[model samples]
Target: MNDREGGPSGLRQRTRRAVQAEIAATAMRLFLEHGFEATTMEQIASEIGISRRSLFRYFGTKEDIVLGDHAENGRTLKAALEARPADEPPWEALRAALKALVESLPYTPEDFLKITGMLHASPSLRGRQLEKRQQWTELLLPDIARRLGATANTMNELRARALVACALACSEAATETWVRSNGTVDMERAFDEAVAAVRA
Candidate 1:
């Protein structure tokens, strides 16, 4: 109730999200400690001092608990891009927003590895992850279309989607580089290089 480390002022929505993130983190730890399939929602809830039902209130399934809520990230990205200086080119704005986002990412490298490993182990989770990406792509497509002042059928639409796709590819490369470097690599630099590689 103390604004959770004196973060944002209003604690209602933010508090709920903070609690949810804690649950997700706790769940990940339990999964890793006790083995993924061996970990139970009840065990996670008990460890976190919450009822299993309360855990369910935040995440419908075990997979949801681990993935956390990525919608916030997508919204933050879109808002950051929209807030960029109007004079900047759209691609520049997107790249800047993404750089800011990578720096501000809440999940640690351990959490990243946990989720990545889980996705690799489970087909259902992999499908869901892909679905989530498609959903983000759909959201991005509209924003891009508006930025280009063109419909989805236009050449601008293709260019916009291509840019988003290219950005995603760069992000993937940056992430892999980050993991390989054991989080020692400058993620922003890797991302910048990835984008630069595309531009070259």
Candidate 2:
């Protein structure tokens, strides 16, 4: 439990997460103000009062800095899926899980729109967003397989993957619709409509 034993203790872990969040917030602020392409790693590092080397220790690239929260969100989505009732149908469970995941997002609607707008506008960030979506699918794979009582067979694996992909597609459609409406539409309602459309 102690840091000296082998790994970081709870407090140390919290402190590290706090620092990472602070760094990410600083980077996002700079990205929004100066534009992602105009912002430099050195500028972000200097803003945080850390050397470029130290900044690299936290994030590999500028794109990684902006997309850093994706990892946490992926973990959250996976956890939400796993926490769904075992007796629930796969599609229903996935729908509820997706709702919980969206509701748990750290950003407000305006902030989410701003961040996604940046991602949509920047080629590098758009590529990173796609990469992160694949990562999210991978994270959900095992849970999807478990929920479906899938055996260790190619067909079963494919089924689980397909289901996860379906859920992701529905969520993406809902998100796009909400964003296009400029946050005027209720996200939960949009999500339900998308899920219903897919089920039909």
Candidate 3:
């Protein structure tokens, strides 16, 4: 197990995080400008002033860099939900967390444009994104299952998966609405409408 307490291990972990952040930021910018498929892992590393081998050590694949944060975000959302007031409902907790998550994202307009374009135009990226979502669902469902006193069986798993999928769908719908409305509809508003649609 990794140690959270301060030590050499902690220091190394922090360094690793900084390196990953640097890599992701650079990769996203390049991917946005050049397109995902056109962007090479070597170019990403070169932009970060690192060797390709070192980049490989940090992220196994180009797709991994783009999709890696889903797992981290899932863990964070879980922890955030757990930390919320016990009286709060699960959906409410998730809603609040989602807003905070968007706020916490370091995405620039350029980054958003790239991701939105790629996700819309590229079937491969969409498929990869779905797989990443599935990975996130797998991480989050076990905790939710335990909370509901249900095992991680197919039915419970499907419910958990559905929750996340609906959330993403709602987010996407809201984004489309925002675009059509000339940015009058912010993502948070869209997310609210999306979640509400799901609840109803």
Best by TM-score: 2
Cα RMSD, model 1: 5.3
lDDT string for model 3 (52-141, tens) is 999999999887888778777767766766676666655666677666666666676645555666665667766777776666556655
User: Model 1: per-residue lDDT, tens digit, 21-118?
Assistant: 78877887887777667888899889999998888888888877755565666777777777787666767777787867666776676776655565
Clashes of 2: 0
Q: Compared with the true structure, what per-residue lDDT tens digits does model 2 show for residues 1-200?
A: 67663456867778777888888999999988898899999999999999999889888998988888888889988889889988777888888887787789778878888777778779998888878988998999887787778577888789988988888887777777777777787877887888788778
Query: lDDT of all the models against the reference?
Result: 0.73, 0.84, 0.73
Each prediction's RMSD over C-alphas, in Å, is: 5.3, 2.8, 3.9
Output the number of the lDDT-best candidate.
2
Ranking by TM-score: 2, 3, 1
Greater lDDT among 2 and 3 belongs to 2
How do the predictions measure up, each by TM-score? Answer: 0.71, 0.84, 0.72
Q: Count the backbone clashes (under 3 Å) in each candidate.
A: 0, 0, 0
Candidate 1: 10-residue stretch with minimal lDDT: 1-10
TM-score of 1: 0.71
